[model samples]
Target: MPKTILILGASYAGTATAHYALKHTIPSLPDPSSFEVVLVAPSRHALCRPATPRALLSDDFFDQDKLFIDVEQQFKQYGERFRFVHGRATRLDTEGRVVSVELVKDAGEGEVTLEVAYHALIIATGSSTPSPLHGLNSSGRDELRAHWTAFRAALPSAKTIVIAGGGPAGIETAGELGEYLNGRAGWFSSKLENPKVKLTVVSREEKILPLLRPSIAQTAEGFLAKVGVDVIRGVSVDSVSPPDGGRGEGGSLTAKTEVKLSNGQTLAADLYIPAYGTIPNTGFVPEGLRAENGRVETNPQTLRVEKAGERVYAVGDASNYARPAVHLIMEVIPVLAANIKRDLLRAAGESPSGEDRVFKEDKREMQFVPIGRSKGVGAAMGFRVPSLLVWLIKGRDYFVSMAGKMWNGQHWAKET
Candidate 1:
């Protein structure tokens, strides 16, 4: 029997790790065919989340087929070396090296329980946001697609759309909506326009993009203003009241939903999107291995699960090493993969070359906030990056063109 290198989550982190193990780690082993990689995730497709902001606007740049890449197809070339399990992890036993999974069944059918034992475990389940429009959360691809359809169907008639959250998702979403719907001449042209809609972004923080430098945040605010998005700061959404009629036409309660702010003000919105409160998908993780915030307690340097055995590892949003960001995810992948490969080599009674990779947290401020299609603000390595460069790098289609490369493991690392 082949030893199973089990990975939880099929998002960018998990998928990249599996590819690295297959292409690099396994090949380095004396008995190459002695191991196989198994990936477990809820959805068969992996969502290209960066493009979601524009995707909400139903942009031709973000086609559903292109945004959601089939996970199974991405690994088809690996053949017997890779196995994709369509399920969600329910429990993890680090000591026993076993994981309890709930296999997704067909519509209207109950989920089937499955127990998988692994020689090594990697947790990359990532995080979830309040709205599926921002993150995949626990919803399957089909369900998420339906959500997009319903949201778009309601957009035409929605006169007022309020987005709550000052984070990247909220700001980006507001920018996309504002520019597409309310932007006048001289702004990036949009094929689909809805000028009747009023877009507002409500942030509990005093300034948006709280993680970025104050100047960068201020620049973002200015960009949003130019795109006709209203930024409401220092107020939180205290309560939300669903429409009394429930499920209005086109499956939206937009016409009647009411949002109460912390400042003792209420606003009736045709569409209310809550983009805050992102929780890591670490429910199945052992309590001892998890931090107070529900993220796995990972050793910042080694990328290993703190308090867990050396064979256990974590990366991406599920790990508490650093704040969740796409660039951070990419940075941690090679470190985690190299460490796992070294450990696996030792277990195989072979001496591995080079020292174990360590992940040093970059203290320099690095962020890119794209306000609209034509403009953005960013900083890298403690220096402010030009807006045009930011737009060219990320704002243009939100890197939708790289979805295929990401899925195929081409983005995992630079080619040797």
Candidate 2:
């Protein structure tokens, strides 16, 4: 008899797990129909979240459709072996091994819920930061497109822009805005007067990009300074005033806001964007499996949901496994898939000693900070790459071109 595997979330981690499972389990099974994999997500699109910071700037560089890849079509080659449900998982009963999902539909009707049973489950719901600057919307493509369109229309008249966080997303957004208003560095191509736009970045920490080494952090600060962006460290936002009025036909909102800071200061701007940290999407998970901050607590060795036993696992930002990154997901998927195969083989009365696997943290120091299309700084495998190289590698296209290939293939698979 075939066993069912239900995977929650259809982003990088979820998608990768599904692909690897098919590769490892299907070919080995005498009856290929003995295994089924089902993926459930709020939307059928695997949104390119890393590109959202740059994409929101304008439509000229980002084609909205490119950010959203159709997940169903991508898995069509598998036929009934794979299934994708366009809905959000609202509840879960780990003991019963059943998940309740709310189906998303275009037709105007009441909500519909479905209960799905699984012999094994993977939770990869991923995390989300504040919107309009942090990440792209996943409800649908139309909602995401509408957000970018409105921001671009309002930008020309937005003389003052205030960003509330100094993380990667905030920094990238600051850089893109700086380049859009003023031309390339050391080039005064624009005839506009001095202070074409007042841009400010507020960081609660003592330094911006605090995760990077001091020298590397300095390099990022230097790039922002060269591009005319004000980097203010050790300050936090206290309150933000509401918009004065609604948006006009041109998609520009009439009212700007006054932002109050912890340093006893106030700054007004045409737009106030929050780029704070990410919050784990673990609400659907059981309380016993969650941490104080709402992140799933998983076994460090096996990556299984703690106390929930070996048949269930959690990965990506939603789990307390370091932090979220595309590379991190790439590293986790294969180990998780191998472990699942080992457990399944054991259930089928086969030897499991050589099949079980463990996950270890990848300590390689890797980070690429691109300010705009032309320049950036990075450290790859502990070696500092030149800014020009960073521009060529990631700053130019925001790596959206490579994301699709990375998601659909097993470029990081490892043999245990």
Candidate 3:
């Protein structure tokens, strides 16, 4: 009988631990034949979300190598040693070390009882953007794309646009739209006709990217100006009323509803993109499993989900790890891998005890805030990140290509 290791979710945390374990442990194990590794996830390939947005905004920035890749295909040459199950997990039996899964596809949904008796488990279900921008919400990708395509087609003619929320998503959209206006300097009527062709960003927070320091916010405001984006700070939108029944030349289809802001003010727009916040998708977790704020709570060091016990775990944005989960895939989690290995080793023998496997992860956080594609800003380790580096790293398509490498190494590396 082979010792089994089950992995649930293969985005950043799940895939990293799997590849690390397979590449390092499979060969070093006392007996390669003694263990069987299985990975369970949807979409066989990992999706580079940071990069996905670029496919919508900029074409010059597109790089084929940066696109997401399939994990099952990456290690398929390894044969049956690694098994890939194509399904969605519906229920979890922590004590029994089994997950009740369902096979989801384009046509319809199906069910499968994948009994993974594991010596170890890795959980890495990531977070998701909560609302829709341009009708592109998570109502299902097809529905979103259908709405977004129609909205984008209508943008060229809109004389004014109102952007709600002053977060990174709003900032990025403002920059992109402003650049488009700037490019049409002489051609478009919106650019030639009136200086009041407004591009407003309404933020509830005093400053955008409030996670960043004061200096960082100041620099970003300057960048927005150069790109032709009107920075509306210190005020909130009260209400938005579209050109009613008899009202004249300009009307907006997308933003017909009235939006009331915190401050005593009102505004209207031909377009609106709500790049607001993310929500963890743990509601789908099995009944007995434990979670907080739609996320699975795991031991900070061990990555072992509390309710699920030894048989299950979670990673990426899905884990209640007491920190904003970053999408950067390179930040290593070797300690988690080591702990999983030790647990398996112990199961393989009479007693699997070894050195302390936990190592403190870096407490500091880092971000690369790109204002459009030309300029950027970032901070890490309490250092005010220089603007130039921010553009090079995050601002230019949000570092999607770099993260894709960590998730899908083989095909992406070859593409480059």
Candidate 4:
């Protein structure tokens, strides 16, 4: 019987780990057929989160279909060695090495539970943003699709759009909207330039993109100004009152609302988008193993779950190893894959080839802020990157082309 390496979440981290394990780790093992990978996730597809900012605009700006990759189909090439479970993990028994999953069911059906035992576990459920476009709320595919549809239907009529949060999501979203409504040419051209649409971004911090250098933030602000986006700093959105007719069904973004600011001011918004604050999807994880902020307490060097015993690991936004960023997740996968392989070899009474890997958090300030399709600002390794470079790197299509490669596991490091 094959030992199961169960992976939770199907987004960037979980899917990448699964592919790395199956492609590199299992094949190099003393007994190649002694292990299998099981990936459990609520949604059937892995969301291409980077492209979501443009994806929320009209289909002319981006094809929303490309924003999601079917997770089950991505694993079919592995045949019986890989299994995809469409469910959400509700509880984890670290001592017993079993996870309790709530299988996804039809709308009217009663709940169904499943207990799956694993030899090793990887928790990579990631985190969720207030806006479904930026991150998964863990409500599954249907709700996500509905939210996309709702946003699309509402965008045309929205006269005032207020985006709360000065983080990357908020800034990126504001840029996309600014360009789309102000008529900027991108990967796809949209002739609809309605400058009448008012765009605003609210940030609690003193400046936007606080992670980047002040000069880079200023440059980004300049780009936003070119596209007619207003930046409100030093105050947060205190409360939001829905439109007179309410937020419509499912709390959709269709109706107008009133936003109250922390500085005692109010603004009427036709569309209210909360783009700040991410909640880690780790409710099933034991409290003792989690940090006070609700992220998994992970070994920064080994990527293992601290105090949860052997063979339990975490990566991506769900873990407290480093600040959450797509670039950081890429750096984490190779280290985690190598460690898991070494640990598995020892458990199977075989000598592993390489020494265990250690992950060191990169301290370099790296960020790319695309103000619009044509212009942007960024910095890498303590140096400022030009606007054209930023546009060429991410602003053009938001790396949508990489989505397929990510799902196919080709992005993993060539050597473990």
Which candidate achieves the best TM-score against the true structure?
4
| Root mean square deviation (Cα) for candidate 3 | 6.0
Highest lDDT: which candidate?
Answer: 4
Candidate 3 segments exceeding 4 Å error: 1-3, 58-60, 108-119, 132-151, 159-163, 181-197, 231-257, 264-266, 286-291, 325-329, 350-354, 359-361, 409-416
Arrange candidates, best lDDT first.
Answer: 4, 1, 2, 3
Report the lDDT tens digits of candidate 1 across residue range 1-416. 88989999998889888888887878877788989999999988888888888886674767777788889998988999999998999999878888999998887998698899898899999998777666567767777666677787777777888889998889988888887877743455422244456778999999898878888898888777766677899999888786421133335534457888999988778888887888899999878889999999999888888577757898888998888887787777778878888888888888888898999888688888788788888888889999999999888878777667778977654522
**For residues 250-284, could you state the per-residue lDDT of candidate 2 as single tens digits?**
23333476878999899887876777867787888
Candidate 3 colliding pairs, count: 10
Clashes of each: 1, 1, 10, 0
Which runs in model 2 stand beyond 4 Å of their true positions? 29-31, 63-65, 187-193, 243-255, 410-416
lDDT for each residue of candidate 3 in 1-416, tens digit (9 for 90 to 100): 67777777766667776777776665656787777778877656665555443445444556644544566876666677788777656666666776665654556644445556676777666665633432222233344444445556766766666666677767777766666565323333323233334566777688887767777887777666665566666666554564331111123335433555676555555665545556665655764454647678777666667677654667677776555445433443666666666666665563555673654456554656676667777787668788777777776766665665466444223111
Task: Estimate candidate 4's RMSD in Å.
Answer: 3.5
Name the regions of candidate 4 deviating beyond 4 angstroms.
Answer: 63-65, 184-194, 242-249, 351-354
Name the weakest run of 10 consecutive residues (lDDT summed) in model 2. Answer: 244-253
Residue 328, model 2: Cα distance from true site in angstroms:
1.1
lDDT string for model 4 (1-416, tens) is 67999999999899999999988988988888878999999988887787778776756765656677788887888899999988999999988889999999887989999999998899999998766766556866567667778887777888888888898889999988887877553334232234567888999999999889888888788777666678999999888886321223455555677889999999888888888888999999999999988999999999998688789999998999999987888888889988998898888888877677999988788988777787888888888999999989988888777667878877664864
- Residue 77, model 3: lDDT of 60
| Model 4 C-alpha lDDT versus the unseen true structure | 0.83
